[model samples]
Target chain A: MDLLERFAKGDDAAFEALFRQFEREVYGWILRIVRDPAAAEDLTVETFWRIYKARARFDPQAPFGAWARRIATNLAIDHLRCRRSEQELPEQLGAPGAPNPALQREAREQIQRAFRRLPAKLQAAATLAFIEEKSYDEISDALGVSIGAVRLRMFRAVRILRKEFNRMGLKP
Target chain B: MTKLENHDDVRAILKKGFPRIRAADEEPRRDLWPAMLRKLDAHALRQRVPWYDWALLGALAGTLAFFPTSILLFMYHL
Candidate 1:
């Protein structure tokens, strides 16, 4: 039998197989939500640790993909909300590898300065819907908004982000 | 975005930049089965006691019930 079939029979190897296959996608999803690699890594680890802890309580017959993805989405959304409440988040993917630290730093600051001009709700909505690539259904579920609201919010968010990028001489 | 939407640029960014994706478990940690078995052991035992255990308790209650009225009558006569 395949590993999934074995997993249904309560096999450890089967669970490990699923974990190995999905962990990368899970981490990437978290990173897209948080935009901070460190936080994403931490939360990714926490997400899996939580699943392991809750494994026995899991009905093996349940839809594992949906169950695992939901846990990850919830953790990331909560993390982002808390961070937003504390202070503004910087708006760069990561530090550039170029030798000019000062110039790179200044450029990043300029981008952030522009990003902060967008409405806060738009910023939050963009990160989840665009960068995170969360489905409209998932975004609505996470944000407690209607699907129509999520769609409207995403449309407005991209327009704002595009304008912000354009001001920095970014074509896209 | 029409072109970008069809193509996953963010996905490309991730696939290019981040390569370290660890599995959701402690590798080489203590054997996992022992812990799973222990949890499974504790899980189902709390629901209902054995039939024999209830039978014994029921018998004890029945004996106590018979003696209670008899003792009350004896005390009244005394």
Candidate 2:
């Protein structure tokens, strides 16, 4: 049997080969969503463990990369949800073109706090759609939803953020 | 302003606030295969049946063997 067939049959060597092939892509995808190297590393491992456990259900003819990405995306969304409950927001390095360092830091912090407070689905969609400038189709695939659903999440995220930012007197 | 302009404003604000997007390291610092192996190992260990559970299962079998009527009781409980 070929690699995909072998992997579906629960062959360890085949699983390892597939893991090596997709490791960087999965890790990079998760890192982009989570934006934390340490958390991304842990989530990547979790994603693969899950993928292996569910191997019996995988169709050999299907694309492995997309399957791996969907698993990684769900794990990243869960991580974000857990972090949201804890209200943890990482500090961003000061960006150029901001005249006041202290004021800029405060604004960024406020934005981060509000952004993190969004529902995990909306947060993920917005992060991929807006900040990363990823295509809607790509975001939809990773999110395991239709393009319409992704657009809805994006709209909700943007509306919530705009309201929060306006209330805080941080206009665009 | 128009709807398009409103969206652009929000997008610009988001870009300004989330500057780390530009600086994020895309590549992982280390291979994660070892970690995946460890997790699989841990799960395999967890999947092993504990002695207590096996003992309980044995006791149930013995009870059912001795009193076939108990099979009805078990089915009822289930």
True contacts kept of 2: 0.69
What lDDT does candidate 2 reach at residue A129? 73
Instruction: Write the residue-wise lDDT of candidate 2 on B1-78 in tens digits.
Output: 122344776777777778644343766788788888888788777679787897999999999999999999999999
In order, the interface RMSDs are 8.0, 3.3
- Can you tell me the CAPRI class of model 1? incorrect
Which run of 10 residues does model 1 chain A get worst, by summed lDDT?
A88-97
Candidate of highest DockQ: 2
**Candidate 2 local lDDT, residue A59:** 98
Q: What is the lDDT of candidate 1?
A: 0.57
Tens-digit lDDT track for model 1 on B1-78?
333373343333322233333343223233333444444455446336787887887886786587877656656787
lDDT of 1 by residue, A1-172 (tens): 8665566566767767777777666666666556666676667666766676677677766667666776877788677656654334344433333468775565555544444454555555566655445577776765557878876776765566564454444332
For each candidate in turn, the TM-score is 0.46, 0.80
Which segments of model 1 are wrong by more than 4 Å?
A: A1-11, A56-63, A85-107, A110-124, A132-146, A152-172, B1-78
